[model samples]
Each structure stands twice: as C-alpha cells, then as structure tokens.
Target chain A: MIEFRHVSKIYGKVKALDDVTFTVGAGSVTGFLGPNGAGKSTALRILVGLARPSSGSATVLGLPYAETACPGLRVGTLLDAGAQHPGRTGREVLTLGAMTLGLPRTRVGEVLDLVGLTERESRRTFGGYSLGMRQRLGIAHALLGAPEVLVLDEPANGLDPQGIRWMRRLLRDLAEAGCAVLLSSHLLHEVEQVADHIVMIGRGRVLAQGTADELSRGRGLEETFLELTAHTDRSPGATASPGAGAGRGSA
Target chain B: MTRAGHHLNDIAGAAPSPITKDEKMNADTPIPFRRLLAVEARKLVDTRSGKIIAVVMVALVVASVVARGAVVGPKLQTLVGTAGIALGTLLPVLGILTVTGEWAHRTALTTFVLEPRRHRVLAAKCLPPLLAAVALSLFAIVVAVPATAVVSEVRNMAANWEVQPLGLLGWTGGNVLVAAAGLALGALLLNAPAAIVINFSTPVLWAVVGRLGSAGAALAEWLDLNTTATPLMRGDMTWSEGARLAASVVFWIVIPMAAGLVRVLREEVT
Candidate 1:
C-alpha cells in the first residue's frame, strides 16, 4: 500500500519529479522503470522522507512514511545498499537496526540467514565485503524488521545470476504473502520477468504504466521502453523547457 | 533457480516467515529512547577512527600524569588537574567525531530511514559525548591516583591526596563544557576535518585577538572559553567571573549548538 499523489520535486531549475503519481497495492510487485536521471531515485527519496517534495505528498499505508509509528517495522527500504558504515561488521549493522526498531536480536540472525550471508561473513567488517555482499547485507537489513512494505532501488545491482534469481523468488514470495513491494531497476528484462505491474518513466514524467502484457503489446517490454524514453532528452537543464513534459515520447 | 535460491526457496516459497507475519500484525510501537541512546553510544567506539581516538585519549591522560609526577613531584591537585589535560583537549574531538562520523560514513541515510524524527536523533546524538566527558573525567582521577602513589614512591616523595570536592566538580564541569562545544561545532558543520580544525583554531585566533589591546582582552573575557574557564577550573569564582563564564559558554556552546540543531533538523539527507 503505497501512493504518490501529484508529487513534484524541484531543485533550483531542475524539476526532478513533475506531477508524478503511482501506486503499489498490497500483495503486488510494481516495477518502477526509468533511465538514468529519470527521477526514480528522487521520487523514492521523497517517498521515504529523505527529501521533501516541493508539492503534493506521498504516503504509505495511509500515512506519510515518516509519520507512521515504527516506520522501520511498517515499511522497509533500501535506497542505497552502500549507505552502511564501512567500519561496522555486517552483524553489527543489522544489530543496530534491530536495536533501533526494538526487534529481537534473533531477527538479525534470521535475516542474515535469509539473505544467504554466513555467520563468518556477517562477522567481517562491511568495508571488506564485496559489492554483492553489501547488497545482501542491505537486503538483510531491509527484511530485519519484518516490514509490510519494501521500497528498494536497484536491489540487484551487484548480485550474481544466482543472487538475482534468489531475489526474484524472495520478492515474489513476499508479495504472495501480502507484502507491498515497489522495486525500481534499470533491468527491463528482469522487471518483465518478475514484476506484476510496470510503470515506465522518462525525464521526470510517467510515460506508460499497465500490466506487462498490456504495455508491451506484442513487441516486448524492452523495445516499448526504449521507444517510449528515446524521444525525451536526458540532460540537467532540459527540465526548464516548455515541451519537456511531452506525452509518451512525442517528438 | 541457483543453489542459493534453492536453499532460500524453502523459506521463501513457504509463504512469509511466521515471525515476520506475526510481527507485522502486532502493535506499532515507536522506538524507545533508551534503545536509541544505546545504539548511538555503541556507534561512538565501533569504528577504527573511534578506537584510535579513544586509545589516544587514554594515552594522553596517562602521559600527562606521569610527566607531571616527574616534573613537579605529583601534588594531588596538580596530578588530578594534569590528568584532565587529555580529557579537556581531546574529549571534544571525540565528540566532534561522533557527530561528523555519521555524515562522513554516509550512514545518515540508514539512520534517518529507521527513525525519521530528526530532532529525536539529534537529541540522542548529543547526550553520549557529555556522558563520556563525565566518565572520562572520573577516569582521569582514577588513573592519577595510582600514578601519584607509584611515581612518588619511586622518587621518594609523599603523595598528596588532599583535593577539594568543589575543585573536582569544577574540573569535570569545564571538561563537559569543552566537549559540548565540540559537539555543537561538529553538528554545525557536519564535517570532521572542518569542525576539528575550526574547534582548535578558534582558541588560537582568540589568543591573537586578546593581544590586540585592552578592548581585545576585554572581549576575550566574554568570548574566549579558555580565558573564562580558568577561574572555573581553579574552583574559585566571583560573580563577575561566573557571569563571564556563562557568556563564553553561550558564545561557544549554546549558540552553535542551537543553530546546528536547526540545520540538522532541516537538512535533506540525499
């Protein structure tokens, strides 16, 4: 249960997000797809209360995410897998999160196990972990509190093939169990394979959104995505133009 | 499915873990302040930089006391006062590190994500260093007691154990004020190198300004914490001296800390 209502974020001359709106219902996986600088990360940041929106609002479970009691337990998020302190052991990082959320210490062990990090690996400092290990640790941290909703950004960035498949199954399983999952990624094909619904964005505007089959038609999701985003110029100062919000990549 | 996926499938495919589902349905309670304090306090000594600073604090205290014993025969007041040198000078650096470390390490995102109330987080961050100042002041006294006995016995001098409780309180209070100044500056800047440099450099600047004339010297009495704090550490104060100390504390600790709190609360953690 996540909703973005007419949300717009402007930083100086750049409109990072413009009248963007979307939703991910309970027991569903909504893949938020966009190119670089497409405002995906900016929108997620606003949703999690890291960055304030210039207009409108975003809410989770009927309340702004920051206002919800024990938000860490109600809504889990992994905006940047590398946001952890490098000097801390993976276990220590998770333990602190557990402490912050008032969760049992065993939850740390369970999530560490769920994310496929071994006890030995968990004991090692985060600075020494590989990028894939960081992603796992981040995922473990997101799941540590048993949240009802997950807002993840590029969760599969450093994962191997196996790790990717495991993540797909985990998201699917979480959705099956009635967790709302909003996943953002650049991997169009992976989004096609796992996402129950798709929202395509380009240049801070929603380009298209529907079930995979409906949006892809017969041409497949990748070609449709490229065709939709290709007409929008991806540059820093392009947001000020009158025609920047052209619908569906109209040239 | 990959090998890891197969292993996790048993847990994943079997629907949500019972614990997770149960907890999700359980009552929504806010994070307790005690837990936040414990977490913030643990973060202080958890890093390599944090450990290095701590070890340096201990070493400086020991070195100062032993050197005092060698040079001045370890009088009780001097021994205790000398041992506080490390705490007064460097404990604030520790305070600076605790605040700036969150920004330097990029853990602010994670911290804010878990607990979005920035003011609550700031409040939690502020208390640990003040507590450390009190603890370390006592620790310095603890280390000085043994050093006084051992050093006096080695050099064939009697150890003086007579020091006023008021004097000890003054010493600890001054150290706490200095540490609070450090915390305030760190929060104001949110950068370790910048805050630490500014924290150390302001006193030197004040020393130079104090040499300008009677006006500069008078200004320093109200602005330079080092000058105003002397009477405080000596356990003697007139009403005028107390007022001056209060003025300097406001200039050094209160103003910066209040401004820093506003900045921290309004800051966007991107």
Candidate 2:
C-alpha cells in the first residue's frame, strides 16, 4: 500500500502538488489521471522517493519510501522509458536493476521474456529501440525484483494497440498477485478498462476519486472524465471526441 | 462450555502472539553499504564502455613497452615520458566517459532509483576506476620489466632503466586523482563531450599561460595542473614543491569533486 499524507511539492512560485493526499490499496490497480503539468509525474516521483515533498510525507507499506531498506525490491518504478543508458542492451539494463536489489541475474532474462522482448534483448541497444520497445524494456526493468508495489508514469506511452493490450494484462496480473499497482495515464478509456480505482487531479489538486463505474456514473467514461476535469485553465479545452468516446467504451 | 472449549479459550488468551524474533531481526536489518557498492561496481563492469576502456588501457601500456623496447633504444626514457603524456590525456577522457555514461544513456534515473542514496552511488562509481588505475599502473610496471630486460640484452648496454616504485605509486595516485576530478567534472557538466574537452583543455591552457614570461611561469608553477602532476610523477621535487603539488591537486580535484557530488545529489535526474 502507498499513502500520501498532505504531500506538497513546489517549484519556485508554482505549486506542483498542492497538499495532495490519497491511498493506493493493495491487490488493486489505481490509475492516476491528470492533464499535462498537473502534478501526476511529480506525485509519482514523490511516491518512489525520487523527489521529496515540500511538506508532509509519502509512505510505502507504512514506512517512508526514502527510508525503505530495499527500495528496488519493495517498489518497482518506470518513471520514464527514456530514463536509461542508450548505449546498453536491454538485457544489460535489466540486469543492472536486478543486481541492485540483490536479485538473481537470471531474473533479467525472465523479465525480458515476460515483456516479450527476449528475442531482441541482446541485439537491441537503447538508443536504437523504438519508443514502444523502450517502454517495454523500461517495464521489464521495473519488474526486475518482482516488487510488491509498482509505480509507473505513463507506462503505455509509445505503445501500439497490441503492446497496450499486453501492458493492460501485465498490470492486471501484477495487481492480482497483491501488488499495489499505481500508474498514471492521460488516456481515461485505458484507465477505465484496467483500473480498479481512479484518482483524478486537475491543476495539481484532486478533483475526483473512486472506481471507474462509480466516477463516470452512467455516462461514457471518457465523456464523464472530460466533464469532471472540464475547468479550462486546468485542462486547456482538450475533450474526448464522440468517435473516441465510442471507440473507447467498446474497447 | 465443555472442558476442551474452556481449555482452548484459556490457551488463546494466554498464548503469546506469533511474532517471531526472526521477523523483528528481518525488519531491523538495513541493507549493507558494501552490498550497495558491490551492486554499483557490477553495473560499471558489465557495460560495454567499461570493458572497452579496460582493454584500451592495457593495449596502450603493452604497445608502449613493445614499441620502445623493439624500435627505440637509448630513448626508452623519452618513450616512457611520451606514454605518460598520452595517459594524462586519455585517462581524463575515460573518466568523463565513465561518469557521463549514466546520464547519456538515461540510466541515471534507474541508478538513483535502485540506490536512492545518491552519494553512495557516486562513491561506488569512483571506486572501480580508482582501483583499476592502481592495478593498471602495477601491470604496466610488470610488463615494462620484461620489455626492458629484452631491450638491454639486445642492445648489450647495462639496463639503467630502473623502475622507481615510489614514482610509480605517486604517478598512479596522481592519475587516479585526475580521473576522479574528470569524473566529478563529468557529473557537473552531465555531457561527455563537454566534460572531456574541459578536462583536457584546462592543463593545456595552463601550459600556454606558463610560456608568457617569468611572472607567468611562477604563476603557472604554483597554479598549473601539469606542473603539480610533473613533480609528483617524476619524484623530482623538494619538500616545499611537494606541498605545493599536494595543495594544487586538492584545489583542483577535491573542490570539483565535492561540487559535482552536490550537483548529483541535488539535481533532478531528467
């Protein structure tokens, strides 16, 4: 379980996360939803101990994330797909992460296979990897220790339809095994399909939180998402189109 | 209630909780520093760049020994001197490559995520190169031994090329210091090309300044990296000169290293 207790972050004069508070329960997939620059990434970083909150605290499994004895083993994260050494092969990158957690080196190959990158693991350099491939590799690295909690920021970014499907399934499996899976995405429909719970933020403040069906009411998930996060200054007038709404609900 | 039910209830109330001492021990045991360092070292060694740099250093040392022993006779000292110059130029470049490799590959995030204590990660990164520098220096001396003997036999002249163990140690120490300084600079710059350029150019610029006049020479002798490193490497300095050399290294290497470490710990990995 991950808990944010009055956590706040500021950059210069702008408040990146404004006294945010939430809980991600175990055995469930929690989707963090917000428009760009809405503190989604900042909140995720704080949860993973990459960034300290300006005020208050974040905890993973009742202990401070920063104070966790084995952060790599306890909480796996993929904050950004691009955050890897481009010169290293996929296998090498995963192995490095595994070693940090005192995990067996063989787990590197296992993750590669899990992410469906086993064939290209040795041959693909990070610099040459396509965006989708990089995302998959990043996910593989995050899964290195079989961490109890998984924190992913835009894990589906750069993935195609097939890759996205794989990702949804992967996240579900992880949550089913009692891992607290917290992922951020701009795609509400994807969240609606996969998330057991939803935490919505706008302009660095929570606007809504509940299950997908509970949050959307009887309206289409995307339409309801757009309506709930409709404040112009926060979202910049980007709303789900009718066709997108239909396609998403069917999917 | 039956006698058995009464006994079970009494047992349930009287029995201590099942929290074992082992569970408490597991919770209290923090991850060891050595384990984290070993993990960092493993990452450093596993990379292609790390392997290439090691291979290149060995190749350069062997080639220097063979070429000087086989081709150049009386100028063996000069060849050694040339090799020293080449190493001074190259070691810093390798150091920059080592430090910036994390950033260039976007692996800094992964590295720091694994070891959230950034300072520990930085220290681990420095350890491998420093050890390798000392080890390579010893290896170079050993290789030079056989090559020097072979040259003496071929030329029929007394092998006056004595290996100064202290000189080797000082030179190796100086190289490690410079390499660390380069690593720090790379961390601060966070770009491989820029860090390498600054590392190599700083000494060259000081040399140019030294050529201006007596005053410039004096200033250079006091402030210049080459002047400081030369005395330490060659064992040709008085006590006062050695102190000055030590001071110069501290100023150049220690200050930059501290600054780089600060930057690494404070700056967000983008």
Candidate 3:
C-alpha cells in the first residue's frame, strides 16, 4: 500500500503541493485526477522517492520509499515513458529492469508479450518507437517487477483507442489480482470506466475522494469532477488554504 | 459516519502498518555492487556514441604506431610513447562519456531509480573506463611489437629490443590516471559536450600559460596535469618530482571527483 499524509512540497517560494493527503490500497484502482500544474506529477514523484516532500510523509509498506530495501519488489512506478536511454533496444531495457529486480531473463520475454510488444518491436531501439510504442514499453517496465503496488502518471497519453482498451483491462486485472493501482489521466471517461475509487485534487488540494457511486451521486462522474475543480483552473493559490483539503482528505 | 467522514478513514487508515524486522531486513538487501559494475560496462559498449569512440581509440593507437614505425624508425619504447599519447588523450574522452552520458541522455532517471544509492552508481561508471584504459595500454604493446619488427625488416635498421618494464608500466599508469581525471570532470559537470570541452582544453590552455615565464613555470610544475604526467610516464622521476606529480593529481582528479560525488548524491531525480 501507498500513503501520503498531510504532504506538502515547496519549490523555492511556489507550493507545488499544499497540505495534500491520500492513500492507495490493495485490490483497488484509484484514479488521481487534477488539472495541469495542480501538483499531480510532483505528488507521484514524491511517492516514488524521485522528489522529496518539503514536509509530511510519503511511504510504501510503512517505510520511506528510499528506505524500503527491495523497492522494486514492493512498488512499481512509471513516471515517464521518455525517460529511458533511446539507444537501448526495448528488450534490453526490460532486461535491465528485470535484472535489477533479480528476476530471471525469461521474465523479460513474458512481459514483452504481455504488453503486446512483438518480438520485432522489442528488437528496435526506443528512439525509433512511436509514442504508443513507448507507452507500451513503459508499461512493460512497470510490470517487470510484478509488485503489489503500481503508480503511473499520464500513462495513456499517446495510446490509440485499441491500446487504451487493452490498458483498461490490464489495470483492472492487476487490481483484481490484489495490486494497489494509482493512475493519473486527463481521460475522465477512462477513469470512470475503470476506477473502483476516485481521488480528485484541484490546485494541490483534495477536492473530493470516494467510491465511484458515492462521487457520482447519480449525476455522473464528469459533471462532478469539473464542478469541483472549475474554481482551481482560474487561480491555484487562491484555494490553497491551510485547512482546505482537510475535510476531503479525512473522508 | 457521514460518507465523507467514512472515506477519510480510508485515507487515515491506509498508512502502512509497521514492518517486521525480517521484512525490514529483506528490504535492506540492495542490488549487488558487481551487477552495478557490469551494467555500467555494458552501457559503455552498447550505444552508437560509445562504439564510435571505441573504434576511434583503436584506430588512434594503431595509426600512431604505424606512423612512428615508418617515419622515426622507432624502437619499442619510442613506439610506445606515441601510442601512449594517442591512447591517453582519447581514452579520457571515453571515460568522460561513461559518467556524463546518463545525464545528457536523461537516463539517470532509470539508473537512479533502479539503484537509488548514487555512490554505487558512480563507482560502477568509473569501473569500465579504468578497465578500458588498461586494455588500450595492452593493445599498444600488441601493435608496437609487430611495428618494431616490420620497421627493422623494411629499413635495415637495428630493432632495439631494449625494454624498460617500469617505463612501459608507468606510461600505462599515466593513461589510466588521465582516464580517471576525465571521469572526475564529467561527474563534476554533468553535461557531455561541456565536460568534453573542459577536459580536453584544460591541459592545452595550461601548456600555453606555462610558456610565459618563471612564475608560469612554477605554476605549471605544481598544477599543469600534462606536464606533471610527462616525467611520470617516462618513469624517470626523482622523489621531489613524484611529490609534484601527486600534487597535480590531487587538484585535477581528487578534488573535482569529491565535489562531483556530493552533488550527484544530493540531486533530486525530478
């Protein structure tokens, strides 16, 4: 499981995250929704120990992510698909990750097939891959460890309709297999279709969080999300009150 | 509880329970150091840039021996001198690439993510370049042996079989030192082009300054890496000369590398 408690991140004078808090648990798919510049990436980066939080805590399995020892075996993260060495073949990239996790090389081929990357696709260097191919490779990288927790930010950005459909099923299956899955996306429909739980943040504050039925209120997911986050797009700092997210985070 | 109130319980409640001692111990086992070194080595030979630099280094070693053999009618050690310069100058660039490539290509995210302890990663990067320097030195000997015999055969000159084992070893050591200096500069300035420009230019610019006067010569004696390394490479240095060599290496190699390590360790991955 992953948890962020009253977390805040300040870059110079800018408060990227403002007293934000949430948790992701086993057997659940949580959609992390926020507008651009709303600290979604910062929060995810902190959760994975890629960035440090100015105050409060981000932990995996009850310890700091950096201190978790075998982190790859406990949690998997995909912050960006373009962060890999472009000259390395897709197969070599997965092999590196698998080796880091101490898994056998055969697992590399299995993950390649699972992500729908054909033998031919895996042979090419990442520089030649289209955005869709990069996304698949990134997914394959995340799944290489088969950890109980998964964190992915904007993972479906460049995928086709068919690819997106495949991803939705894959994530759902992983969650059903008792993994905690947290993903952030601009695709509300995709989130609505797959998310068992939803956590919405606006201007670095938790606007709302709950089960789909509870958040929808019989009205629908899109209307509730836009209505809550509309004020944030206008001015991020105006809503960054100290106690702003307390009620939502508590829930 | 109200729906919002109950949901807050999930947030507060999901804080991971305390891990057992066994679990903590399990988590403590980091990836082995040997594996990290192996990965760093593979990265050196796996890319187009790495491969190109390697080919250029090999060609430089061979070309120098051939030129000296034909023109100077060289002995073994004389042939070794030309090979040393060619290898010494170029291998440092390869060493620089090993550290700065991850930063330039933004592959640090993947590398650091897999091995969060930055020091281990840096040490791993230093490993392959040092080995390359040693291997290049050996290749120089391989090329020189044949070139020496060919020069003697073609020109009807005596093949000077006289060899100084220590001088040859010292020359190889000089190349290894320069390779390390390159890595230090690369780590200190985590950009490939910037590190490359600075690493190559420092010695040349210092040489020009060293020609000015007595004060300039004094400064060069203590700090100019190329000048200090020359006598050391020939294995003809006195005790005082060895001290000067040590002093130069301290400034060029040790200090920059120490600072570079501190910066790399503290840098945020984002």
Candidate 4:
C-alpha cells in the first residue's frame, strides 16, 4: 500500500502538489489522471522517494519510501523509459539492478523473458532501442525483485495497440496477485478500461477521486473528464468571456 | 498383509518431520553487504572499459620495462619509477571515465534505484579502482624485473637493480591514493574532461607558481605533485622534505576527495 498524507510540493513559487492526500490500496490498480502541467509526475516522483514533498510525507507499506528496508524489494518504479544507461545492453542493465537488490542472477533472464525481450536482450542497447522496446525494458526492470508495489509514469506513451494491450494485461495481472499498482497516463479511455480506481487532478490539486464508474457518473469518461477540468484554466490569466478579447481590442 | 504393513511403517519412519509453522516464520536471513560488494566489483570488471583499462596498463608496463632496459643503460629502477609516473597519468583518467560513465550513460538512476543508499554506491565505485591501481603497480614491478635482467644479459652491463621494497610499497600506496583522489575529483567535477584536466594540471600549476621567486619556489616545493613526491617514496628526501611531501599528498589528494564526496551527496544526479 502507498499513502500520501497532506503532501505538498513547490517548484520555486509555483505549487506542484497542493495539500494532496490519497491512498493506493493493495490488489487494485489506481490510475493517476491529470492534464498537462498538473502534479501527476511530481506526486509519482515523491511516492518513489525520488523527489521529497515540501510538507507531509509518502509511505510505502507503512514505512517512509526512502527509509524502508529493502525499498527495491517492496516497491518497483519506472519514472521514465529513457532514464537508463545508453551503453548497457538490456540484460546487463537488469542484472545490475538485480545485484543491487540482492536478487538471484537468473532473475535478469527471467524478467527479459517476462517482458518478451529475451530474443533481443543481448543485441539491443538502450540508446538503440525503439520507444516501445524501451518501455518494455523499463517495465521488465521495475519487475526485477517481484516488488509488491509498482509505480509507473506515462507507461503507455509510445506503445502501439498490441503493446498497450500487453501492458494493460500485465498491470492487471500484477494487481490481481496482490500488488498495488499506481500508473499515470493522459489517455482517459485507457485508464477507464484498466483502472479500478481513479484520482483526477487539475492545476496541481485533486479535483476528483473514486472508481471510474463513480467519477464518470452517467457521462462518457472523456466527456466527464472534460467537464471536470474544462473550467480550470491552466494558464494564470486565462479569461472565460470570449467577447472580452473583442471588447479589449475595440477599446 | 503383514509384510506390506511393515514396509509402510518403515517408509513412514524414514520420512523427516516437517518444521513447525512458528519456526518457519521466525527464521531470519541477514542482508549480504559483502556479497553485494563482490557483485558490484564483478559488474565493473566485466564491462568493456574495465577490460580495456586493465589490458592497456599491462601493455604499458611491459613497454616501459623494455624501453628503459634497452636505452637507459641499467638504470632500470629509475626507469621503472619513470614508467610509474606515466602510468600515474592514466589513473586519474580512468577514475574520471568511471564516474562520468554513470551520468553519460544514464546508469546513475538505475544504480541509485537499486542501492538507494548513495554512499554505498560511491564506495563500491571507488573500491575497484583503488584495488586495480595497486595490482597494476605491483604487476608493473614484476614486469620490470625480468625485462631488466634480460636487458642486462644482452647488453653485457652490470645491472644495478636497487630493489627498495619500502620505496616500492610507498610508490604503490601513492598510486592508490592518486587513483582515489582522481575518483573524488571526478565526483566533484562530474565531467570527464574537466576533472581530468584539473587533477592533471594541479602539480604543474604549483610548480610554475613556485618558480617566480624564493617564496614562490618554497610554495612550489611545498605543493609537491606526485612527481616531486616520487623522490620521497624512494627514501631520497631529507626529514623536512619528507614532511613537506606528505603535506602535499594530503592537500592535493585528501582535501579534494572530501570536497568531492560532499558534492556527490548534495548535488542532484543529472
């Protein structure tokens, strides 16, 4: 289980997460939804112990994420697919991660096979990998220790239809086996299909949180999302009146 | 029926009793820090750059022995020391490469993710290079010995091989310190070229500054680079000179290393 308690983050004068609080329960997939410039990535970074909150704290399995015993064993995270060594082969990269976690060496090959990259494991360098391939490798790396909690940010960014289906199934399977899965994506339909719970944010604040059905209500998921965030202008000086611009020009 | 019953009884007696649930739950397994270090060391050794550095050091050692034996006329010991100086130049370069490789390749994230304890990762990175420097220096001596002997035989000159064991030990220690200092500088600068240049040029810069006047010369002497410190390791320095050499090592190597460690801990890994 992952818990965020009254977490707040600031980047200079701008607030990245404003007094946010939420829980990701075990045996379920929670989709983190936010429009561009929202606190989705910041929140995820804090959860994984990469970025600290300006106030409050984040915990994984009741212990602070940074202070947990064997954090790699408890939580697996993929913040970005491109955040890896370009020179290392897929197998080498996974092996390094496994070694650090005190896992068996054979786990490296197992993860490669699990992610369907066994064939290209030795031949593919991270720098040369396709976006889809890198995504798969990232997921494989995150699963290295069979972690109980998995956190992924923008996991399906470059995936095709087939890869997307594979990712959805993998995430569901992980959750079904009693792992807490927190995934962030901009695609509403994808989240609607795969997420059991949703946390929606706009302008660095949680606007809504519940099951997809509850959040969407009677409207289409996309329409409901639009309705929730439509009035929340991301820009600081955005105006609601269309005729205001014309009136100002005439003046 | 009796025989079958006896056989069944024997089989049941042979089977071991199962462990109690409480005992199984209470069993404790300790984390293996030593094993983790070994694994990290193995990973570093298995890399392409690691192998290249090892091979190049060996080759340089051999070449140095041969060139010195053939041309320097039985001043084999001095020649080996000269070779040590040349090999010393590569030590800092290797250190720079090791640290910068993490950032250049984006592996620092993977490394930090697994260990999470940044200090342990830094320690692991430093250990291999220090060990390698010592091993390479000793190997250089071994190579120098045989080559000197052969050259002595071929040239028909009396080979005065002054094997100063303490001096050799001191030189090896100095080399290890130099490598560690390099690694620390690499961490501080976090750039290969900049760190290497700064470390390589410090002694020279001190020497140039020292040559300006009496005060400058005294300061330069005090700021001995590995080059000036080389004579001390050979036991050729006076008491005052030896103290000055030790001070130089501390200033040039120790201080920079501490600063680098601070930077590494505080700075964001880019």
Quote the TM-score that chain A achieves in each candidate: 0.93, 0.91, 0.91, 0.92
Q: Write the per-residue lDDT of candidate 3 for residues A1-251, one digit (tens) a residue.
A: 88999999898888888888888899889999876667888898888777888999988878888787778756777888988778889998888877666666777776787778999999999899999999999888877666678889988889999999988877876776677999986567777788998888877788899988999889987667766766666344536442433333221
Minimum summed lDDT over a 10-residue window in model 2 chain A is located at A242-251
The residue-by-residue lDDT of candidate 3 on B70-185, one tens digit each, is: 99895988898899878877877887788888877777877776677789889999988998999999999989999999999999999987778888888888999999999998
Q: How much is A60 displaced in model 3, in angstroms?
A: 0.9
lDDT score, residue B74, model 3? 53
**After superposition, candidate 1 runs with Cα above 4 Å error:** A235-251, B1-27
Superposed on all Cα atoms, the candidates' RMSDs to the truth, in angstroms, are: 3.9, 7.2, 6.9, 8.4
Winner on lDDT (3 vs 4): 3
lDDT, residue B252, candidate 3: 86
CAPRI band for model 1: acceptable
| Colliding residue pairs in candidate 1 | none
Of 1 and 2, the candidate ranking higher by TM-score: 1
Comparing candidate 2 with candidate 3, which one achieves the higher lDDT? 3
* lDDT of model 3, residue B21: 24
Residue B60 lDDT (model 1): 84
Clashes of 2: 6
- Residue A140 deviation, candidate 1, in Å? 0.4
TM-score for each model: 0.93, 0.86, 0.89, 0.86
Candidate 1 residues B1-270, lDDT tens each? 355345444654222454555655432777778888999998888777678887888888888988887888857789879877778789778889888888988899999999998888888988998998898888888888888888789999888888988888999999999999999999899999999999889888998889989999899878898889888888997899999999999988899989988988888886
Off by over 4 Å in 4: A227-251, B1-31, B212-218, B236-239
- Cα error, candidate 4, residue B114 (Å): 1.5
Relative to the real complex, the DockQ score for model 2 comes to 0.25
Candidate 3: regions farther than 4 A off: A234-251, B1-28, B211-215
lDDT of 2: 0.73
- Sorted on DockQ, highest at the top, how do the candidates line up? 1, 2, 3, 4
